[model samples]
Target: EAGVVQSPRYKIIEKKQPVAFWCNPISGHNTLYWYLQNLGQGPELLIRYENEEAVDDSQLPKDRFSAERLKGVDSTLKIQPAELGDSAVYLCASSLGAGGETQYFGPGTRLLVL
Candidate 1:
């Protein structure tokens, strides 16, 4: 998959800069996830954490991106020295738990690295 996709809803920035996105999930939700979506594609899971412990992060790009769930209520995703290929829509979702529960997604953070 391409590292980034173009879109009008965007947070514009120069390449090699740092960027961060935040998400606040609904009350009582304990499972948080971060995803990336390119144009015309479904969101791809990047990381998932339960109550501040990362349970799934095999797809996350650790060298450039990092994520944390503080107190299991709010989450943050940060990219250091973000590259041009890092532009895309970042999605945040949360569920009551890690199984088949309905996940609530936030309005994604669209990034455009120039």
Candidate 2:
């Protein structure tokens, strides 16, 4: 089975510019989560989706970041007016969501800001 898919694998943008990242979760998984990983730090939850419903997004920066799962399958995350500090790895994970199943992660989208 194909694991999560993310693109460009890397990105370079200037501060204050808008950028977007895409994610395709593992097939048959019902829970999807987006996370931000700063250098030397563990991934922190940005948002989570249970099918098409966004069940958790309390950690997302509402002022500049937005995400969606239109079909309850694939997802997209957007950062508008991104700041220099926003340069980090955006990871996408998925799990069966049954009794603390392990979440599988993608290679991650690496963003660089000038």
Candidate 3:
């Protein structure tokens, strides 16, 4: 079985610019994910949804970053007026169900803000 798919595997932009990333999860997976991984640190959950409702988004910066899984299959994460501090790898993952299940991850969209 294939893992999740994320587009534009790399991105570069100036500070305060807007950027968006797209993800397509594996077939039959009900949960999709978005996470942030800074240099030398483990990935941190940003937003997670099962079917179309976000179940965990406590770490997501609502002021600048947002995500949605409108159809429960594909998802998008957007950052408006992105900050230089936001330069990191945005990872996409999926699992059959929520909570403690093994997730399949994509290569991720690495962002570099100048």
lDDT of 2 by residue, 10-96 (tens): 999999999999999899988999999999999999999999899989999999999999999989999999999999999999988
lDDT tens string, model 3, 1-114?
777899889999999999999999999999888999999999999998988999999999999999988888899999998999999999999999976889999999999999
TM-score of each: 0.89, 0.97, 0.96
The deviation in Å at residue 107 for candidate 2 is: 0.3
Identify the runs in model 2 with alpha carbons over 4 angstroms from their true place.
none
Q: Which 10 successive residues of model 2 have the least lDDT summed?
A: 93-102
lDDT of residue 36 for candidate 1: 97
CA lDDT of each prediction against the hidden true structure: 0.83, 0.93, 0.93
Compose the digit string of candidate 1's lDDT tens values, residues 26-66: 77778888899987899999999898999999999999999
Off by over 4 Å in 1: 1-9
A best-first ranking of the candidates according to their TM-score comes to 2, 3, 1
Question: Candidate 3: misplaced stretches above 4 Å?
Answer: none
